[model samples]
Target: MAAATASSPLNLLGFNRKPIFHCKLSSPRCRPTFLMPPGRVPSNSIARTGRTFSNPPSYVLTCLVIPPPPKRQKPKAIIQFIGGAFIGAVPEVTYSYLLEMLAMEGYLVICVPYNVTFDHAEITRRVSERFSSCLDSILGSGLPDLGLSALEVSDLPLYSVGHSNGALLQTLTGSYFSERIPKANVIISYNNRPASEAVPYFKQLGLVVSQMLPVAATFPVNSVVEVASGNAWKLLLDTAETVVPNYDLKAFGSFMTRFTDQLPLIINELAEGISEFKPTPPENLESIRELYNVQSTLLVKFDSDTIDETDQLEETLKPRIETFGGKLEKAVLSGNHITPCLQELRWEVGNVYTPADALGQVLKNVSVNDTRRLATTITNWLDLLSH
Candidate 1:
């Protein structure tokens, strides 16, 4: 019959090509169908089929959901306080008072107990020994285990605040252990005298007399008088020259005036006690000399009366601290050195009050903000490392 055409057979099967059905067609008129081999349909071809397939666009849908990132961890901060001269005899009430204030501000503060002997030589030795022990304790007990526990050491910050002699001790300790211990972000010195000039004038005079008097007495009276006076003048001159360069005399003057004024009773007590003063030993002379020569930081917080002296001391120390890559920040407080511990007695109508309250009030006024800021700074630093 007519020549078989490709279009005629494909149109009848409803496919582009003829379907191969190997079954009877007369009894059932078999329906033609096309089977797609596995993976035979190209992705592009399936995509092109689009609406032509039985499944419509609305019949199937897909979506992706990404969870938000976790929050970061914050760091921990530690504050160490070194107390000042004759701190041992002073009641622990003041220490506890300060601790309470700092604790209220959410600071973990350690009040370090240092050597507080009246003898400078003994004080120096005890300071050195105690400081070393404290440092060892910090590294061994606290720092090493900080990261292992809930508190991470890597992110924690360390700070130190010292008062009077304690301030001097901490400055020396900080200098000595600068390379070994963790860096102290903030170091506060409270009412501290310079270590380079801590020795009193009377002590210096005694030291000179004990050292040079033997050589002078083996001469004529006039000669001895002349020689002794000359030696005395020389000693005084030398001491002045040596001590002036190492200390801020203007600051010292202010300190002496305020200290002498604020605690008139204490000064009176000291003056009365001076009548029983004894001579310093010859063997400890060198130690005394060394103490005056050692370099350390000096911090003095100023009240209304100490403003001028505070300024002078700050100006004097600024250049020196700059040279050492350090800084001196001066602060003025609303109360004197004895207010923080004494607030409880502010409204005492006629009751007798201990100096502890006054001392606490002063400390509270001076250190409350500082302690809190230091704690927050340390916490922030620790948090950064955890992230």
Candidate 2:
């Protein structure tokens, strides 16, 4: 079979994988999904809208939790993983290889996917709170007894793991919500740039395109987002089974139907958030020092990532971690910022090795062994967490 592929890709980002939600439509099945656009206070969204306009379309913090290695009698640790940028919203598909590798090592992996938004602080809190609630629900023995309903990791060390933008959130969750996050944070390809730099280049392209429009021409942002959403789902449909873990194509039609239904409302949320910044200070620095209780942080930086802001993060975190005797470790891996986003790609040659194998090899990675190396490195790091 051929490896999962993207056709003339949009560089990176912009796929809205509808979650298998019995809860909310926005979050990825295990999670809720919402795009908070710029300037909107995420808290204000929760302040309960007008009596008529309730039930805002947004993501809840549901996560995909894969059980530990099937053969292992006892699991080693539990990982709370968040991805970066737009791909972060569909981490099970985008970061499946690395996460699956971690799972095979007897780590119970919980992957939290989030929509892209300027309100990182708000999004982080949503992710953090939802993770707590999701974990409780999973462990509470809820109705139907889902896959991992009976499993218990209460005694196991809880590690906060993240990639790219997720690294930023994990750092915050480790710091702001440090009490609940025992063990340490495993931050990979950390990025914490402000709104301008943080937003995807795809949105930036939209801005550029808008500037070139005729003076009399007017276009709705919803239409633009809709077009983008359509293209993204197309890509997902083509590659789901290959990239996403055990994805069932039977759900493809339903997924597309749901994505189309939610696109307009998601766009409306984006439009409404254009000018609302009620709960200001988009980051949490005031109380993290005092509340920062996590024992340590492992910062992973990529060699070729010019956009990576882990150095700045290191400067901020090193002092805080060492203030009361905690370790702030660092590692520079080889790859671009998206190294951790690599998915497993292989083509079973029908008769003999074909040119597609060469293509697969190229598409597998731009950097040599970055994904597997990352998985092994993180595995070793998490193992050391127990010591």
User: What is each predicted model's overall lDDT from 0 to 1?
Assistant: 0.35, 0.57
Model 1 score (lDDT): 0.35
Q: Candidate 2, after superposition: displacement of residue 88 in Å? A: 1.6
- Candidate that would win on lDDT: 2
Candidate 2 Cα errors over 4 Å, as ranges: 1-61, 142-152, 200-291, 354-368
Clashes per model (N, Cα, C within 3 A) = 18, 15
Q: Across residues 1-387, which tens digit of lDDT does each residue of candidate 2 receive?
A: 011111111211222222111332233343313333332224233212111111112222355566554456556766888887667755544566677778778787777756655566777788887677666554444212223332334445677788887877776676666346746687887765644354445345444544554541466755655565466566765676565444444334333433354444333444444322212223444334445656666777778998887777666666676676676667777778877876545434456778887777776554337888878878876676565
Q: What is the overall TM-score of model 2 with all chains considered together?
A: 0.66
lDDT of 2 at 89: 59
Kindly report which residue stretches of model 1 are placed more than 4 angstroms away from their true locations once superposed: 1-75, 88-92, 118-125, 131-135, 138-155, 175-177, 180-300, 305-313, 343-387
